[model samples]
Target: MERPELPLPQLHAFVVLAEELHFGHAATRLGIAQPPLSQQIRRLEDKVGYALFTREPGRIGLTPAGRELLPAARHALTDLADGLTAARQVGSGRAGRLRIGFAASVALTVLPGLLRTFRGRFPAVDLDIREMTTAPQLAALREGSIDIGLLREPPAHDTELGFETVLDEPFVAVLSASHPLATQRAVRVEQLANCPFVLLPRTVGPSLYDQITNLCIAAGFTPQVTQHAVEWQTVCALVETGLGVSLAPESIRRIRLKGVAFRRIEPNAARTRVAVAWRKSDSNPLVPRLRAAFDQDPPDGPRRRPNQ
Candidate 1:
């Protein structure tokens, strides 16, 4: 058996004829002359190798084949229309998937609120989020594995990417609730000189890692590196087990993780200047909308400079 290829125009004509059950009415519905409509129906019937409709002098009725094809034809037309709509939406960035990589600290910061706002404005943009440290995020961006990255500033020379700063947050001390400093209202950089420190690896987020150590060195002692983790929550988790103290952005306190107490650090100008990073040549239009979403006010407070 061979399948007859139905052209779209012919399919449309058949569907209209099936609904109207008369050549004149179907022609009127299609805004065409009855003679032309009749000619089109005859051509379709010839190709189909059977009469789709039994045409009497004044009335027309669908044959068994026409009835079966009516539903299939209607479904095919609907599918085609929907597919075209989807194509249009995707082309305009009104609907599509955006893969984004973020550091875990972002969970406690402005990223969530930024995402909510983006969704509110563009509900059709699907977000694919991955929690990665700054270093991995850089690699991901260069590899085109992610559309954007929410992370702190990279070193001056990692210039293969573009970036937009979302917020500048101050760093604070994060210690286990059971640790001695948990009772204190705040801790100083010098005070932590000799304590075992749980830190994010330098390979992951060099900026913050150097900031914590440099601040400690300036305060008079090098920290004893006791543990390292990439994700902020994991770093906090190790602290919960009383592994060591860690320096984190002030926004991290919002995580509300049990067994951890966050204290403001003194005399140290340490802070995490978080930014959204992407490939320099990346052309996904969704990226701009996302940046616009993040450009809004920081969720927790008034706008502050990097030092704030």
Candidate 2:
């Protein structure tokens, strides 16, 4: 059988009375009149189904039942107080769990600094960080699996999500260390017309995939894509093996493969943007807070929409 629910006020009164063992002193400690304190103890005992105190002329003491209930009631009250404190901290955005999904490429650029700033400001917030590609990161944000997304080339029009540009970086040509163009201070996009290309499949990142292809077209030749790799590092590795040359974000140069060389694209008008993305309908307070971390702006900073 289930025990009756005990009122918090009654339990509080009972604990105070048990500690003082004197109605006058207990009432004083609880800031209540003696009669009401006694009445609360009686109500708690009724719920507990036991006599909680023994009373005699000029003397008062706890019965065995009262002694047993004291420790449990004290522990319950302590736990409740701790839980309330934690909830308040979370409500104020000072402490809580924030799940962030980020592109692997940004880990080479913005991710580290963003994390450092957020951790410094909100030391109590627990972070669940996952490395994901643009497509998966967007999916996770919509599904509520991640609170924030740091990704490349967020879609230009997505009513379901809000985005802000965090970094705008130019593309660079990646070549094998021994390739002829590797020693060039800068390479024009059109110079690679005859070279077979290694590229990321459009399925993984449509915007970025199209950006590269469109840059090639603007240079007057559609890249003859000969191989596909999902990650920038893999693309660089393929270039290193002389499988094909590629173009990637300037951040890709940080991968540091000894056999790979990165050269600036002359007239580097084609730039890639990394953005912070979140569901527009998201109610998590941490979402806005984290987005600010991405921009190194205050939480109230001006909002930048996708593709801006």
Compare the candidates by TM-score and give the number of the best one: 2
- Which residue pairs overlap in candidate 1's backbone? none
Against the true structure, candidate 1 reaches a TM-score of 0.85
* Candidate 2 ranges beyond 4 A from true positions: 295-308
Quantify how close model 1 is to the true structure by its C-alpha RMSD in Å. 3.3
TM-score of each: 0.85, 0.94
Question: Where in model 1 is the C-alpha error above 4 Å?
Answer: 155-160, 177-184, 257-259, 295-297, 301-308
Model 2, CA-based lDDT: 0.88
Encode model 2's per-residue lDDT on 87-192: one tens digit a residue: 9989988899999998889888788888899999999999999999999999998889998998889998897888888778889999999999998999999999
Error of 1 at 159 (Å): 5.3
